[model samples]
Target chain A: MEALIEEPGTADTTWESRLEAKALIPGTSTGVAFKLWVGGLLLVLLVGIVAYVNQYNNGLYVTGMRDRISWGIYIAAFVFFAGISMAGTLMSAILRITRATWRTPITRVAEAITVMGLITAGVFVIVDMGQPLRLYQMYLNGNWQSPLMWDMMAITVYLTSSVVYLLVPMIPDLAFFRDRLPGRVPHVQSWMYGTLSFGWIENPPQRRALAKAVAILTVLIIPVAVSVHTVLSFVFSTTVRVSWNSTSFGFFFVAGAIFSGVAVLIIVFAIVRRRYHLEEYITERQFTYLGYLLAAMSMIMIYTNATEFITKGFKASDDDLFAFRELFATKFAPLFWFYFFGGLVLPVLIVAFKRTRTITGLVVASSFAVVAMFIERYFIVVAGMSVPLMPYEPSSYMPTATEWAIVAGGFALFMLFLTLFTRLFPIVAIWEMKEEHETRVEVAP
Target chain B: MIVDLRHCDGCQSQGTAPQCTLATIEGHLLPEPMEWIEVYESPLEGGGTQFVPTPCQQCQNPPCVNVCPVAATFSAPEGVVLIDQDRCIGCRMCMAACPYDRRFFNWGSPPVPPEALLADYSMEHQVQAKVGTVTKCDFCVDMVRAGSLPHCVAGCPQGAIYYGDLEEDLATNGKTLVSFKDFTTNNNAYRLKEELGTHPRVWYIPGHGEAVGRDPHTTGRMPTKWPWIERAKGAVTWKR
Candidate 1:
């Protein structure tokens, strides 16, 4: 394994250090952990399936949703997953556009999260839809003018762009795996990886072509990311519903998405970095830098939330006031406060304070922020709907066992994708790291 | 339709003997302003409430029609807005678009009894009420299409609501059939928000003698009948 990693054509010192890092941990045994993880994931999935079956047999009645609170956990899960997926696109686009050197070590991890998050995001939409099978008919006979259509279009574009972005960087690594670890992996894996390499003879033309595709996809993903969040906001804002009827909803949603996305990336990257024994590749500096980035986003997120709440509160329209009261003074008050302080303020404060700027502290803060963002999405969706328009109290929502099971299943699904991805390919973008080493003259991790 | 603002003394004192009021299909008699026909205060050209009793406009180019993604809402050939409940996605896009906010979403199972659900539902009429679909003043298309006056038209004791055929240039308030054009022109009749270009089929002969200016606090509901509904105030109102 050492000899394979330190092959002559690979970049010299960095590859040697990474090989040493891998030796520190017993390789091959992770497959056991993978098995356990997969088993747990399947259990979660089965539980969720049972709950969903119940919901289907009965009506949405099993859920707490009333007419006043039409949206709830499903929409929150959708937003959380969508927000997390933006990490890949934003990171890839930033790295590609600026031609950043140090991004190589973390780009693959980020991109894989994006793909998994997006798949779950798509699934969340189905869970939210009262009529899931009819979701296809949304395509067959869609209203182009509806914001829901725009959401469909943007998410599709984002998914396509992320897959292409992931693939462009995987070509050389697939070739490496094909040649280096033949019998260790399954035959089907070998054939798929071999085919994915597109017959790369380790030649200059193939590298150039792959690089060009990567560059194009990187650039293409940014607008798609922005569009997805914007269209999502439109789904709520296009309505006359007072609280959601703001023009600033797009910017607010996008800022929140990016903030949450960055936090998820930080947490996922930390986990993979530790598990893969890639300490030498992903340095402490990366965490600190990402820490600073997360802090900036947290501040921006705070600003966006303040903007949305203050302006709407001033209007005092019956519906808007009712919405605000529900979120701030009623059933959602605790969650709303928790999201604002725990999700936004605390993370920002921890990163800002000198004492908590260490790598471990940053990781803990990032994880907290991710959880808080999910809470925030839930409050925004469910609480927003809690305000009834007529002479009535807004509806109340409670997720049944089925809803809880599905949510757990979604988390397990995310972990499962990440687990499968790391086992099959180099968690780090090896070729990009090589290029960075050759060009940047940065110190070896 | 005309609303005599002078006569409406706001929501009449609860104990006041009711002169006029609106009753729902369920036989719940509400105050005058709460009637199927609403009298709104309008901007006065000079002075006095420009009382307008708004019934279902039965619009020719209804704003509601353009917003229904599933074609759930369509105008009858005779010019009435109708909803095909079965086809509605419960998205409520039309409810948001209507300037008058006339549409209502059935957020949960309607309060109606199970026996009422046995009737057939059609695009021409709404009978079987479903949970999660929208309902509104459908201009009683089912009745009008059957060569009859709408329920509200027949229910109005003041002859306040007029059903009409624009193509035949005729209209009737059940008591009087008048030439649509001459009646409108002679009465200085108008549709609400003419500049919005909604092309409403319902026309009104403005009343109130001129006390115009919308009182923000005064909703259209007026004082009216039924001791039982008032006595049963604490009972849960149906979701519909």
Candidate 2:
């Protein structure tokens, strides 16, 4: 039994110590680069806040959204962020369940993104509404049959579980920060660590309890995550619009979630790796592995796009033809082609080629995927609405300056969350990586 | 439910729309600015033209009601769909879901006329005069409850629009009352986009721009005037 344990203690312990010594060290201060990045985001966010205030005061009239195009960039951004958030559960829980060894160092980055993404996604939905306070009215006078109600319920469930999923793994790490960082940072932050750590002493019983909780939560969150993505797509599919009323939408959206989720995961991974200089933890192998995932996702996305087009193109309802023409031939052609070529095609080519499978290539590819997926969401919503359900002339939806400012604010807020998260806590899951090493080492209890 | 296209030539002769839209806005003082009925001039395939006057289909399975998160829009017991502007959170999901494009939103202050001030608000006779909410053709629910034809049915100058009690099998175009089943069957009336299973109660009796002396090549449409612009000098009103 002892011999069956695969711990070569010397090699394993040295690696474990290295991870502990370097990876756990917080960036010394808000460095000039960090300050500049945050300051820029803050400026954008402030501008956006002003725009949002103006929208509230002046009514939705400040935006270009007419009755014809009721939804605009805010709803689009909601879908984009909601889909991107799946990276957390996808990277952490699903990969953990599958027992992927290489996912350990990068899971925290994914989970942090999930938290930030889900929150910002919800924020955009509020922004889209004529009255943000009506969100509560929806809950109070809830309609069981409304897809919007279902969407709200699904988001609440998913968000709760995601927060738990994010926090559970961070407990021991929080305790670590609590014990290690108080002397180094300000008193208020130190107090925060102490309060959140929940006295995690890491005794065998406590450790077992947390492990059990994490395991249960991991199993619990997958369906919830799937539901969040599906329900959002349902908001469109359930509508009577010919282009959106397809049965294939749920599966298509889930695929899109994974595609964008993995793309964002790679981009975040690259930034963390570069900024923290944790080359050893986030390896070239990680890039290669993610490249394979990205390629598969690109293929799936392209296939879904093609299927959506072919199925609609074959019958060619007048509405379908009009939308298809707009999507493929005219107004939206530039955006459609850019996403097809730059987001889908370029990503596939980059990931498939060994030379371009480097971290830089992966980052570039993921950037295209992220931006294009955002546009895809925008296209799906605006294009769907752009076609007047009646024979009335088709009206165009262009985002107003206010809308653009709010969108920029949303992006800045998301980055601000990640930035603040990294400043206070280790961006990598410290305890989990150590645990993995310990199990491999088979050290004495 | 049947529009007899053979007898109807959209408003080519009348010089105005099925005027129920004017009646609705003036009657309800609604802020949603909904035209209870709308007229469309669609080009026909054989180099002719057609007239499509859309009313609230009052679908058996309403997409608007189901998508409204707050139950702001709902179907009444008699099958006419309605919106409660008071309860509406202004999410506009109802607007998005209505395939007929019958729904309208109050983006800002609804322009109200002096006459509409002090109008009692009800779900059926809405002054949705609220700043942010959805409103649509309610099938003149208030008027029907008062034992009257829908405003549109009464207002159409050419007597083209019809109102009916489907359950009772009676209908009227203001001038003549007839059997709902007989009139539809005789006219070969069909619901718009019946393939979608919306089961819209409003039926088209078919027209090739011929009724009211329509000219297919003319491409003329009824001009929609908001009606209040002709107010007698200094009519007192409420704004907000």
Q: Indicate the DockQ of the complex predicted as candidate 1.
A: 0.13
* Alpha carbon deviation, residue B235, candidate 2 (Å): 16
Query: In candidate 2, which residue ranges exceed 4 Å CA deviation?
Result: A1-17, A442-445, B1-9, B30-34, B209-211, B229-240
**Which candidate should be chosen as best, given DockQ against the real structure?**
2
Tens digit per residue, CA lDDT, model 1, A1-445: 4554454645555654555335323222355666787798888887887877776655455666544455678878988898888888777787568766566678888899899999999987776554455555556666676666678888888888888888878888777766765665568877887898888777888778887887777777888888899888887777656667789989988888888888988888787787776788788877887888899999998888888788878777767777787888888888888888888888888898889988788888888899889988887777766665433334577776768888888888788888778777667777777776665556544
lDDT of 2 by residue, A199-283 (tens): 8999999989998999999898999999889988999999988778788888888888889999998988888787777898899
Docking class of 1: incorrect
Model 2 chain A is weakest, by summed lDDT over 10 consecutive residues, at A1-10
Clash tally, candidates in order: 15, 13
Per-candidate TM-score against the hidden true structure: 0.78, 0.93
